[model samples]
Target: MFGDLTGIMGKLKETQKKIEETKKRLDSVLIDESSSDGLLKITITANRQIKAVDIAPSLFEDREQLEDYLVITLNKAIEKATKVNEAELASVAKDGMPNIPGMDMFK
Candidate 1:
């Protein structure tokens, strides 16, 4: 019936709003990570966008060492940011979906 269709459309609009809000929140989330020696630091958003990178002046002495540390630190920072982003999106999906029977198996 038309009434049922209208109700469903309303729910869909509300769910879309929640998803947009979640995306905005995720953009504002910054994940900071540092190298093992604390000589390197990187800041990235939950959406995997690099915001900033800081390296200690002392690291300028060795180019190879600096490159290695940068590579490792960058990879770890990206991985951490990606995992947090995925978890946040997953939470949104879980909240938006209806509680149907046997859904626990998928979760």
Candidate 2:
């Protein structure tokens, strides 16, 4: 029984390492989002770090409109980044997990 526990602990540690590695990898995965009119564009990492933003000169004519575009586009980019981050991390964790009898958390 102790041996089994030790093996499970070791597996858990390995899984944690893989999850960390995946998180680092996700830092490089970029998600791009644009406004409906294509006046604003945002790029973010799967880790939800903003990488770049490109705005069309037309959006500069109105401050409120530019702010609204930024809000909407950034939110969309963040949502997409979150989805990618979660999926990638979950995949790594699930694949590396040990087959413990009562551990069906992934399902």
Candidate 3:
């Protein structure tokens, strides 16, 4: 019984290490997405943090058009960030937990 507990503890420690490594990778991931017309740009981290936004100077005069493009670009950036984060997490899970069933569902 003591041996079994020790083995479980070892696995838990390994899992914790993997989780920390994966989090570091996620935090370092960066993605850039642009609007269809090339007027707006956004940079986001895999952990869904918005880092920067670049907008065309001409759009500054029209709040309505600027708002529309900002919404579209931000959505695309968020989607891209989410996909990257999911892929990274899935990779980590697969590497650390091969015994888990239905792991591909995370993809």
Which candidate number has the best lDDT? 2
Q: Which pairs clash inside model 2?
A: none
Give me the candidate number with maximum TM-score. 2
lDDT of 3 at 30: 88
Q: What tens digits encode model 1's per-residue C-alpha lDDT throughout 1-107?
A: 68776776777677778878888898889999999889999999988888999999999999999999889998998999899988877777666665445756437
Q: What are the per-model C-alpha RMSD values against the true structure?
A: 2.5, 0.7, 3.0
TM-scores of all candidate predictions against the true structure = 0.79, 0.96, 0.81
Tell me the spans in candidate 3 whose CA falls farther than 4 Å from its real position.
Answer: 98-107
- Model 1 poorest ten-residue lDDT run: 97-106
* Worst 10 contiguous positions by lDDT, candidate 3: 98-107
After the best TM-score superposition of candidate 2, give how far the Cα of residue 98 lies from its true spot, in angstroms.
1.3
Cα lDDT listed for each candidate: 0.84, 0.94, 0.81
- Model 2 agreement with the true structure over 35-99: per-residue lDDT tens digits: 98888999999999999999999889999999999999999999999999999999998998889
Reference-based TM-score, model 3: 0.81
Model 3 error, position 48 (Å): 1.0
Residue 14, model 2: lDDT of: 93
Pairs with backbone N, CA or C atoms under 3 Å apart (clashes), candidate 3 = none
